[model samples]
Target: MPALTDKQKRFVAEYLVDLNATQAAIRAGYSAKTAEQQASRLLRNVQVRAAVEQGQQKTAAKLEVTKERIVEELAKIGFSNMLDYMRAGHDGDPYLDFSELTRDQAAALSEVTVEDFKDGRGEDARDVRRVKFKLHDKKGALVDLAKMLGFMVEKHEVTGKDGGPIQTETRTWREVLRQEKKG
Candidate 1:
């Protein structure tokens, strides 16, 4: 393969940041007026394409990211039942046992927060601790999983004003008037 120029290499690196070609071209010092065209032209080059692919592979390798792994993580979130984390404490009060989180549950966890509140006077004070768990959107994860597994398809139907089937080949008043005039 032919060696890429310094600007081309920079463009490859910038493109990976957000996968925006025009922005990458502009950042790579291409003329702003022609950045879009330059981006398209550069992207079409075989050498540039190979470089981008190589860069992506290297990055994915470094990050240990893979399609199967991503889907498996999403599946974990999609199938995770909150019941698994809920357990009764020694006092029989229902509470989440953080230690019981599975690999998928751990992956699905987005945020965890603990808050403490004190009530009553100094002579009789009560300390209340609240633990909050913010998990990933299971519905969204399920949707993504369905799409990845080819179980989901975008359903678009042409409907009339009242959701009935669209009546095609129906001419408008203008067409009727024009036909009358032609006749």
Candidate 2:
């Protein structure tokens, strides 16, 4: 394969930043009007595609990212349970107790809030502590993990009304010309 041009090399580098082809083409100095087409054509070129793959591999290696690590991270969020972070006290009231929380379990927590306030007035005043926490999107994490593991495949069915075969119209230019002449 022929070597990639300077603009193509730049496009590969920019593409690695976010994997957006049109933006990469634009950043590589391609005209905005044609950036989408330029990106499409450049990505189809064998040499440019190889360069992009090489760039991606280099990035993954540099970041120390691996398939197992990604799956493990997703699982930590997917399989997390609120019970893992809470426990019942002697009063039988459940409270946020992170005393024995593991790093993996903590990874699921997205937010934590603690409020200290007086619950009553005058002689009946009592200090109250409130704790709230939100977890990461478990469903999203599970879905992503399932897709990565090939356990989930999104299927799309295109059909006409009532699930029948798609309806299409095919017309010849000659027929259109004759109709136009009659009109």
Candidate 3:
């Protein structure tokens, strides 16, 4: 196969930074007006695509990141249960209990707060301990996992007024120019 051009190499490097093709093309010195089209075309080129994949593989190796690892982390947050981090007290009130919290369970925690205060004044005073813990967004993590696994496909439908199909008009450039000259 043909080697990538210098500009294409630059594009592959820039694309790896954030994987935004249009921005990568622009940064690689492609014309801003045509960067989006250029990026699409470049990505379709066999040599460029190979280079980009090779670059990604190298980066993944360096960072020790893999698709399975990412999915596992997302699953940790998606499948985590609140009961894993708390338990029912003698009075039947739920209280935070991390005595048996596992590493996987801890991964799902977003925040934890502990407060100690007096519930009442003087002789009637009682010490109260409050523990609040927030879990990472379970729905968001599940949605991400579903998308990554090809189980969820997001669709956007564009329509005209009243939810009907969009209306479009097609005209040739020559006809448009002639109409403009007449007006």
Candidate 4:
């Protein structure tokens, strides 16, 4: 086996830090065809291996910081859980009426309801609101309401025919109830 020069070893270490062997080879002034061979030799060097390990540690720390930033940003927007954060991705709209949510939408929202929420262990002041309600099917069989509706409870302002505020709170889907009764 041929030993790598000091310069080659350093190149390998730097390339392995962020780029795969092929990319590192090209960056290190080697042809693309030679990149794999150069990377292989570099991996065999004990000194280069140590450098790669140290670089990996630093990279992992940086990724952790990025993850924390995302979590903080989500929290600022009243997303108490990752589920809420991800659900907001659907339709690229942050605000959604509860009735507009489908079964899949509800399931995604429900994932954020931790045991703490059920036990009332913390103050609930997040933008997302939770409501408890029962759902019945056409035969009057009690459906799994929470499972069907998810975690978010929506309240809408009632409006008159002329779009005047009626000062009443109403659910978003009166039609769904009618459909359920007929089914």
Q: What lDDT does each candidate get?
A: 0.90, 0.93, 0.94, 0.53
**What stretches of model 4 exceed 4 Å from their correct place?**
1-6, 13-17, 62-183
Model 2 earns a TM-score of 0.78
Off-target runs (Cα >4 Å) in candidate 1 are 1-3, 88-93, 154-183
Candidate 2 lDDT for residue 156: 88
TM-score (C-alpha, index-matched) for candidate 4: 0.31
Off by over 4 Å in 2: 120-125, 157-183
Query: What's model 1's overall lDDT?
Result: 0.90
Residue 173, model 3, lDDT: 81
**Candidate 2 Cα deviation (angstroms), residue 165:** 9.8
**Considering only N, C-alpha and C atoms within 3 Å, which residue pairs clash in candidate 2?**
none
lDDT score of residue 101 within candidate 1: 63
Give a tens-digit lDDT track for model 1, residues 1-183.
779999999999999999999999999999998799899989999999999999999999999999898899999889887777789878998998878566767887888899999988897999989898887899999999999888998887788979987777888889977986797
Which candidate leads the pack in TM-score?
2
lDDT by residue (5-73, candidate 3, tens digit) is: 899999999999999999999999999987998999899999999999999999999999999999999
lDDT over C-alpha atoms for residue 119 of model 2: 95
lDDT of 2 by residue, 1-183 (tens): 678889889999999999999999999999998799889989999999999989888988999999999999999999999899988999999988898989999899999999999998999999999999999999999999999999999998788999998888887989866975797
In model 3, residue pairs whose N, Cα or C atoms come closer than 3 Å (at least 3 residues apart or on different chains), thus clashing, are: none
Per-residue lDDT of model 4, residues 129-167, tens digit only: 554322213121112232234444556777876898566
Best by lDDT: 3
